[model samples]
Target: MVLQGALGVSLTFNCGDTDVAQEAVERSFAIASERGDPLDRLRLLGPMQMLYFRTGRFGTALHYARELAAVAEELGDADAATLARTFKGVSFHLRGDLRSAREELEGALSGRPPKEVASYLGFEHFLAAIFLARTFWLMGDTDLALEQTADVVSSSEESGHPLSHVITLMWAVTVFLWQGDIEAAENHIDRLETRAAAHGLQAYLAVADGFRGEVAVRRGDAAGGAQRIRAALKELHAARYELLTTPLNVTLAEALCAIGHHAEALEEVRAAINLVETNGDLVYMPDLLRTRGRIEAAMGPRKRDTAEATIHEAVTLSRRQ
Candidate 1:
């Protein structure tokens, strides 16, 4: 019964029914706890953490990750413990604490678990590698970041985990986008779209579309890009996938600014900035701040001081990270 409930949680999450998955995970956790089965409890924590992470509830996800780490330690499960620590690092990444995130993720990657242990843990190592790549990129190590991300993408494809492969590709697209490599980003986005469509992964499909929209905007197709992004945002919001909202909104703001819609762009940027401040999601803060500055600058000389201050803040924060 517990196994069935846990499986249901994964199924519902893949189908983008996050609310149902959360309920199923809670039931599975309760059953596992009642049976005094530590393994089952740990098994249930994976989906619970994923559910919260996708919904942008970083604190709750971090809580589950810490609990998973403690339980894995009690069970003497090194691989599981490593996986839990990686997730904790990812939660820190989402919260914009790159220093702490890098520490934890690097600590986990410093050791290699056996093949069987990694398989038993369900490709968590790959997820950690992807996050680590992003962290490196954000820390201004583009070459190293690309190398690490490429390795993960290759390994994921060879591991026969299609879902993990697709996700890794999505992260790769993000890295390329950040590097201003539009052609490379497009290639990865195309691959991700194909794989996500094949697997019926709605959230990934939306993500792929969002990337495409950003690329289009970068290429000077503001109206077309904004339309695509708006459609993707609607789908993402319906699925309650708030994790990507910050980046997506920042992209939209850039598109609006391109088309001389400073007022709308300012509103969008400000809203995203507010959400980041409220949620402590510092990962995307620098980008949001930069966007806010751009919007303010477009508003004319009267706002120049505000623009300078905002941009300076972004630079300072980015350097600190």
Candidate 2:
């Protein structure tokens, strides 16, 4: 029962159902607390920490991760320990402590727990690879990012893991967009959208649209890209995953700026910054900061120096891993 509830929470969380995820987490925690099973506790801890992290509750997530690590040790479960360390690493990343994040993630990967079972081992590999890919992408090692993504893709296919494939597809899109490979990004988006629709994974569909919007904006198709982004944001909002609204807003801001709506673009960027600050999730704030800087640069010379400095900070922080 406890395991079921934990898995349910994770599923709902991934699908952008925050309220359902919260309820599931609460039930899982209650069950684990009553059962006094260390692994169960760790299981519940993982999604709970992820929820907190996604909502910009980094300090709370960090606290829970530490507690989870201690419990994993008591339970003598190396796998759970590694998972807890991954959360800690993510928390560090959110806090802009990239060096610590890299160190901890490296340690977790180095201490790779042997694959003991076939049923869920594929997920383990995919999760670890995705986490590493994200960290390396942030660190500006695009080659390593692609390599890690390739690992996830291969393992996901070999294991027939649909969810893992979806996640990897998103990661690949982000990397391609960052590398300025519009054609590759579009190809990946098309593939992801087709798969997502066939599987009824609306959240994945929304993410795909968001990525398409990003690529469109980069290609100077302001109207087309903004339309896609607006649709994506509407879907995510309906699903109650406001946690990532910043990215959508930034995408909109870019489109707006391209279309000569400078004042509106500035407003959108400000909203994104406000959302990031409120959520305390600095992991992607650099992107928002950079966007705002660009918007400001177009306004006048008075903002040019400030804009350049902001972009410099973004590049520096993003490469810190």
Candidate 3:
């Protein structure tokens, strides 16, 4: 029954339907409660925590994190303990506690043997790698971020984890965009879109579209980019993933600005900023700030200094140790 529940939850998450995934998680919890198995309960907590984390429910994620940590201690499984730590670390990261987030992730990494991390489960090492990469990215250590992304791609390919590969590709595009390597970014976006379509992974496909839109903006293809971004937003809305909707809007704003639509772009950026602020997603806040600044700069003297200041602040924040 636990196995069936895990499979169901995995399928639901893959399909981009958080509602079905949460229902499966609830079922898993019910089963674990009935069995009174520490290990099973710990296992159930992993997916539930992830669902909460992805949905911007950080408080609930922390609650499940504590529960999972207790269960891991009781069960004494290093892998379980590492997973719980990773989930907890993500909650902290999203909450803007960079120091605490890195501490938790390092602790989780210390608990797992290097060779065994990726082999344990689908998300076991994948999430760890992404978190580490994101941490480095936030710290403006693009070299470290690139190295981590390379390893993630290699490991995911070796393990045949399609979703992990898709995520790795997404981050890789972000990295390239940060480096101003438009060609590399475009290549990665194409690869991600192709793989996602082949695998029928709508969630990752939406992500690919969003990034593709980013690439389009970088190339001054604003109309094309906006079209792609709007499509991505529609898909995200269809999936009821409100948390992910912010990034798409941010991308849309970028495209709008590139097309000399400063006023409309400012509106989009403000909307994204509002969403990220309300949802407490500091992890994505930097991008919102940068977009707003760029749009404001494009709008001319009335907002140039203010926009530049916002961009500088975001840059400083992203470079924080």
lDDT of 1 at 305: 100
Give candidate 3 regions above 4 Å deviation.
1-4, 111-120, 242-244, 312-321
Query: What local distance difference test score does each model get?
Result: 0.84, 0.73, 0.75
Query: Candidate 2 lDDT, tens digit per residue, 156-188?
Result: 656666766766676667767767889978887
Per-residue lDDT of candidate 1, residues 1-321 (tens digit): 466566655665466466667777788888889999898888878878887877777778889889988998999988778878888899889888899999988887877643645544466778888999999999888899999988998998888888889878988888898889999899889889899888888789998898889999989898899999999999888888877888989999989998999999999998888887876667899989999998899889999999999999999988887
lDDT of 3: 0.75
> 287 in model 1: Cα distance from truth in Å?
1.1
Please give each candidate's TM-score.
Answer: 0.95, 0.86, 0.87
By descending TM-score, how would the candidates be arranged?
Answer: 1, 3, 2
Q: Kindly report which residue stretches of model 2 are placed more than 4 angstroms away from their true locations once superposed.
A: 3-7, 10-17, 53-59, 111-114, 117-124, 242-244, 305-309, 312-321
**Best candidate per TM-score, number?**
1
- Model 1: which residue pairs collide? none
Output the number of the lDDT-best candidate.
Answer: 1
Candidate 2's TM-score reads: 0.86
